[model samples]
Target chain A: MVTVTKPLSSTDSPYQSRGLLSTLRRSPLTLLTHLSVIVIVVMWTLPTAGLLISSLRDKEQLAVSGWWTSLSPSTQRLMVRSVPPDAQLEEGGRYVLRGKVSDDQALQVLAFGWSSREPAAYAVGDVAQMRKGQTLSISSNGEYELSSPEPFSGARGKRLFYTAKIPPRFGLDNYREVLTTGGIGQSFINSLTVTIPATVIPILIAAFAAYALSWMAMPGRGLLIALIVGLLVVPLQMSLIPLLRMYNQIGSTFGVDAKSYLGIWLAHTGFGLPLAIYLLRNYIANLPKEIIESARVDGANDFEIFTRIILPLSFPALASFAIFQFLWVWNDLLVATVFLGTGEQQMVLTARLREMLGSYGGNWEVLTASAFVSMAVPLLVFFSLQRYLVRGLLSGSVK
Target chain B: MTHLLSSLVIMLLGVAACGFYFVFSNWLLLRIFPVRRVSLQQQAVNIQRAALIRPWLFLAPALGFLGLYLVYPVVESVRLSLFDRGGDAFVGVANYRWLFASEEFQESLLNNLLWLLVVPACSTFLGLVIAAMTDKVRWGNIAKSLVFMPMAISFIGASIIWKFIYEYRGEGSEQIGLLNAVVEYLGGTAQPWITLHFWNNLFLMVILVWIQTGFAMVILSAALRGIPEETVEAAVLDGANGVQIFFKIMIPQIWSTIAVVWTTITITVLKVFDIVLAMTNGQWKTQVLANMMYDWMFRGGGDFGRGAAIAVIIMVAVIPVMIWNIRQANAQMEGR
Candidate 1:
């Protein structure tokens, strides 16, 4: 029988190395590593998780409580007004005012008090002394009863305070409100509108350019490739002032609107081309020389070889670049803010979210929901095509 | 609804137009050259001529966009920096003079320096440590994914997420923010985290670190895995401890990769705008160069000269990295 042995690399499973596994098992370091990793993972994910949880919580509850307390019932101090003298009824020779402290049937009142200074002074079912000859008591089920020996006489009802344990409530109300009233729905559409064309156009343009740079034996290919690598790091800030000026000049000469979807699309395509071309060229050049040579031998022109063979084979690279460009254009605030107008019609999700942050800074309910609305598409893309994203990152930066 | 429909139409038209350009141009080139049917010598000449012209056809649209958008803007920005706010009169370094003298500019510069120093280092270090640690664990992929999730979020989205964590309530009220709630639980007082001078800059940096550490981790993890096992086995045979192996053997091998991650994050740090703009809008000493440049662009009917000068400053800062990148790429190509 023939025996085969494979060489082990650093990527090999530790379990495959019996000595390493035994040592790892013998030491406490493994435990520490696992524990610390768990901690780091929690620290990294908690903020986004909190935002997600908060966006689903009741807006009123979201305002008063932290998101950590979202899964369990939260204790909240609340107040209710008793019935006035006109609504009082004679019960067993006493005037009584009876009502539920809250409309929520599920609320469990833990304590009750007449004064805000000590909102939880008395336990549930305890009768407390009142200013007049009145006595008050609250049940755990948010029921309250007030009675007076002689008769209740007042224009307004007396204020009673209680602390209630509210059951955790989760819903899509925040998303609904933001989408309908907060204008995030429009901005979501705007983001998609900006992203799809920006991504597709650049991929097509860069793919052609990359094919030429890779296989076409063109003059200046080296210089062009170097130029692209240099352009990869050019700050987008450098492009803004001049482009704005050019667009304005063009707008005046042609009497067209300065900020249009066409202008932003073109702008995105330009800014995105360098990285797109660089990544695609890196991928395409490394494709097997034999495939292209054989195709050429079979009398296939460069265009047919590219369209039929190289393009299909380059799907992984294309998908990765597509994801990168999509996330970039979708989540972009600076480019969108600069190239596009900030009107209600033109505002993308990031821009709208920023405006909301300024206008509704305190409204966490709105802000969290809108932020998630802006985040949802990218998060979906990230989770679904993460493999391609990582591969792209590896190829793009790690030579 | 109408807005969406119109945008959809435009998107379709734009994509169709790009597709048509490539196909039509290629067909036209082939038709003009007519390499398939002609005299032998003529056909050979036509093939060579078409080979020369076809690549340009493939390259023209991309080059046009790059030139018009990136290259032209660079030169125009420098020229605009020399001109007045209206971009008509040549003022000759007046914007640079004003930039140096301005207190806000100095403040922004200092804050940017602090951000540049802290964010990249923290993120890279944390990422390296996490990557090393996670490699040994069984659930490492899951852990890495959770840590890397923040990268998917926009800077604005991350700002909001962290802002919620750093939220503050008055002294007597129940603290809704996690940081303050923790503080109160730990017998300390809740304070506004983002408004505190000097420290608030650190607070903003934390958000970026949180977002970028994942990027650093993913890249460095791959680098770590690429290390040959024989070297690690040798280290183990030599009785080197885990820390010694990590620092002495493993780290040295991945230094270039670490540099790559660090420089990438540094470039990102230099251009960070959305977080600051969303969190504090450069209030409370959190101003950065990108945000400041954006501010000057439209602060009061816009000061184009100052804005473009600030952009030039950013461009100057990036040039070294740019040159380094080109050198690295060229070296890699030559090695290949």
Candidate 2:
């Protein structure tokens, strides 16, 4: 027998020399791995963090800049009404219109400019004086001046610069508004109605198809499988018009109509079937034949073989596909729009999210919270059934 | 009467199995493939026999549904594909020619090609790497789950999430996207990442890749586990280090599993429509086949025939991949 020879001559046993913690600490890959873990966790959480914060803060703060800039107060230059345009007061030599505008603190005004595009470069408490055809003069608190042969509005309108202190405040108002005002709560229920049935029916129907296709001795099985696989690429868009026609015909036959939850659900199930059957068939077919044969020998018929033996063994695959189907159906907007409602009762979470994006997209807090709310169920489902996802459901079953 | 009861029981059992094929295949091929009628006549098979009635009993419901839902619509879609939206007149493949001549449709096809070539390749590669890296670690499963989390998210959800990441604001306004927030913090202006045309399409691709990477990892991880540990130890004994063992031995062994994982994701990437639809609305030159089909069929020209033509194109594109998948699956089945 040719035996392999060892290498690494004259090396001390590193495991013996170093403790596990010490070795782990020194291992660069492990260190890098941990660092990446932290980086990723933070990256995933931070936007949500900022979004939550921005939502809690005053809406004005959200508009002026990013939530991060909320760390310091934001400044704006405004021409505050000095005694309004109509208010007149006589003091000493003539009439002096007086109202104080001041911005000072850690958030003290730096500079004010004539336009919002150039809000800075002229400091706070600066006064520009002008009279047309005479001389226009402008002076800052720093005694900087601009003078021309012509007078200004002496009044291009007085530009006032003052930084306002904004304190961080937290509230559940965004969630509340999204829930109550945005009709998201109703959409959430609608989405669940669509998603749950769509997911369950396909899986239930496909499970049987898969078992018969994979295990049951049946003629034309290969052709059926091929046909289903071919249908996998048939875009749902192609069938919408035809399906609606069928739905209309069927509905009228049964006193039903063009748009309803049933239409959306059935549409989704049909759309979801090709992949579900393909996936479930692949998984069930790959399950150990001997176990199934053993069950058969034990006097369990096909139905009993499926329920007791295959169901438990196939949980991981079923769960994985369930997650897939659930997510797809939950987030579908097109089918719902076509077959279901434009009404409040008919909108799904995705459609609601679209509306929110169009109208309140600039509101960081509302958008973030609403987005996360839309994301919440999927995240929950993903995390819960995630273990089954890693299992090789097809392993030890196929070639 | 007893024979009727027994055949009725067989029909009921057939219905329960949900495989109408067992009963109907014998009947369906009678005219289409046309088996020997003379032998059948000699054998005295009767079309009016209760046996024939029994088969139809089991087959009727499934066949009816299939015909109404699947087969009939397919036929209608084909016919619709050859006509205008109203089904008013024969367009005679005009939509197909128009689509073929249109630069926009051509661009969409190219984008689909990019998706086919790029998303699966990059996703599988990243997934494979991540799987291999984290396979042995104590926290590997956790890491895998975190990465795979995107997979469970609806494409729209992922789009929403990544949209926030790619959120753009005009110059002088704070970028609301998470990516822009970081870039701005690091003293860079917020760039319109997703609207950057081709690069933006790649940005959309990242979401698919993110979703699929976990799938790749999970499958590839199983393949990695199936790598015989003894073989690995033996390689080590031959003075092979981690890199050499992985390249020379481990890779060669797990090549088939890699192919399976790669092709599965490739098929999925071909069907990716929702992500692009949700994210950019296929604007700024990011249209793909499915989205184009929707726009043409539903919104713009209402050209059903062209829509079917594109759907057919996708199906044709997928045929080779399906064959490869089946062959590999068959091999793997026999291996077991």
Return the interface RMSD of model 2. 10.6
TM-score of 2: 0.75
The DockQ value obtained for model 1 is 0.61
lDDT for each residue of candidate 2 in A1-399, tens digit (9 for 90 to 100): 111111111122224444547757777766665566555545434534565566566665566666666766665444332223234344433333334443322333345444445545444555533333221112322222233342223323334433334444457777888788778887787777667666765566666667777776656666676666656555565566678666767888989666886677567767777666767777777687789889877855455676688768777667767777777777676677668766787778887777766676566567666766887887787677655434322331122
Scored by lDDT, model 1 comes in at 0.89
lDDT tens digits, residues B143-184, model 2? 666766666566666676677678788887657566887888
Candidate 2 wrong stretches, greater than 4 Å: A1-20, A33-58, A67-161, A226-238, A248-256, A274-318, A392-399, B1-75, B181-189, B331-336
lDDT of 1 by residue, A1-399 (tens): 110111112345574355545756776888788789989998998898899999999998999999998888998888878777788899999989898888887899999999989888999878998877789999999888989898877698889999989999999999999999988998888888888788888888899999999999888998999999988989999999999988988999999999988899899999999999988888888898899999999988788898999899888889989999998998899999988999888899999989998899899999999999999999999999988888788888835
Clashes of 1: 0
Q: Which stretches of candidate 1 lie over 4 Å from their true place?
A: A1-11, A16-24, A83-86, A90-95, A147-156
Q: Compare the candidates by lDDT and give the number of the best one.
A: 1
DockQ of each: 0.61, 0.17
Instruction: Residues B269-329, candidate 1: write the lDDT tens digits.
Output: 9999999999999999899999999999988988999999999999999998888988899
Q: Estimate each model's TM-score.
A: 0.95, 0.75
